[model samples]
Target: MLHDAKLPKTLWGECIRHAVWLKNRTLTKVLQGKTPYEVAFKRKPNLANVPDWGAKVFVSKKSKSKLLVHARIGRWVGFNDDVEDFEVSKGHRIYWEDSRSVTVERTVVFRKDEGKVRGFIEVEEEGVEVGIEGEGSVNNPNNPANAHISNSPTSPETPRSESLEPV
Candidate 1:
């Protein structure tokens, strides 16, 4: 996972920890098709918050300067099980935010490769229509084209914007 994410070898430990977390949530034949997490916790894991390993994340920053950028780019590294927070890496440091505190944006733009835009994913507020740049949109959730993304559970509480203030 570390190599696939194009991350440095120094992040191997973080990658391993993330991998184990994912493994625990995955189904296995050894466990009779039940996830290890299910066996231990007696409930299905909520995978809605999981992001791609090392994917670029826009972490909100705290600053009084009006001209300063409100967000900083970081790499999604792992999850803090104790606090139920998402872990992000900025430089050599790791930051954690509560799952409820993190807002999942509908639109995601992929990075350019070889001077060409890779593609993007967009979800509308009303009915969802997921589509790639060259591919047609998929309106049906059961369609294979929409299999890559899943709808997250919504809450009545409004999403709060908080700074990724370093400790």
Candidate 2:
């Protein structure tokens, strides 16, 4: 599934780790409808800790430097059952580069939108194609093609600006 997803080879280890974690909890007819986790531990595995594999997430960092931000932008890649922590990617550069940015940390924030990308959602408000303004104002009704369009500040459509603000 990792290869089919077009994920890089360096991520294969992480993907395999996640797959193994999931496989242990899956039921099989050969096991008399018992999961490997249940058979080995004599208890049902906790599924609550499991998260979406490729979802965007942020990892919290513990540092002494004031310049360091509280969190690092990353993606959830794997889980380490030994330490009860998640393996998150600081960036894709860690795949090929010498950077050892991948870390196991319990403090992680997953995107609220689930399967969709964070910051922006394509909502066809009143059938208007809300997009970059070409010439006239994006919301100008003079062009029937442009209907009641709004990238409302109150809405999640403009989450990027809100996130950049000093916390």
Q: Quick one: RMSD of model 1?
A: 15.5
**Candidate number achieving the greatest lDDT relative to the actual structure:** 2
lDDT of 2 by residue, 1-167 (tens): 45643455678777877788789899999999999988977878778756567556766679899897987766667665544332233232212123534556667787666654333345756654444444454555666666655545664554435445675
Model 1, CA-based lDDT: 0.60
Clashing pairs in 2: none
For candidate 2, the 10 contiguous residues with the lowest summed lDDT are 88-97
What tens digits encode model 1's per-residue C-alpha lDDT throughout 56-78? 66656677999998776556666
TM-score of 2: 0.54
lDDT, candidate 2, residue 28? 91
The local distance difference test score of each candidate is 0.60, 0.61
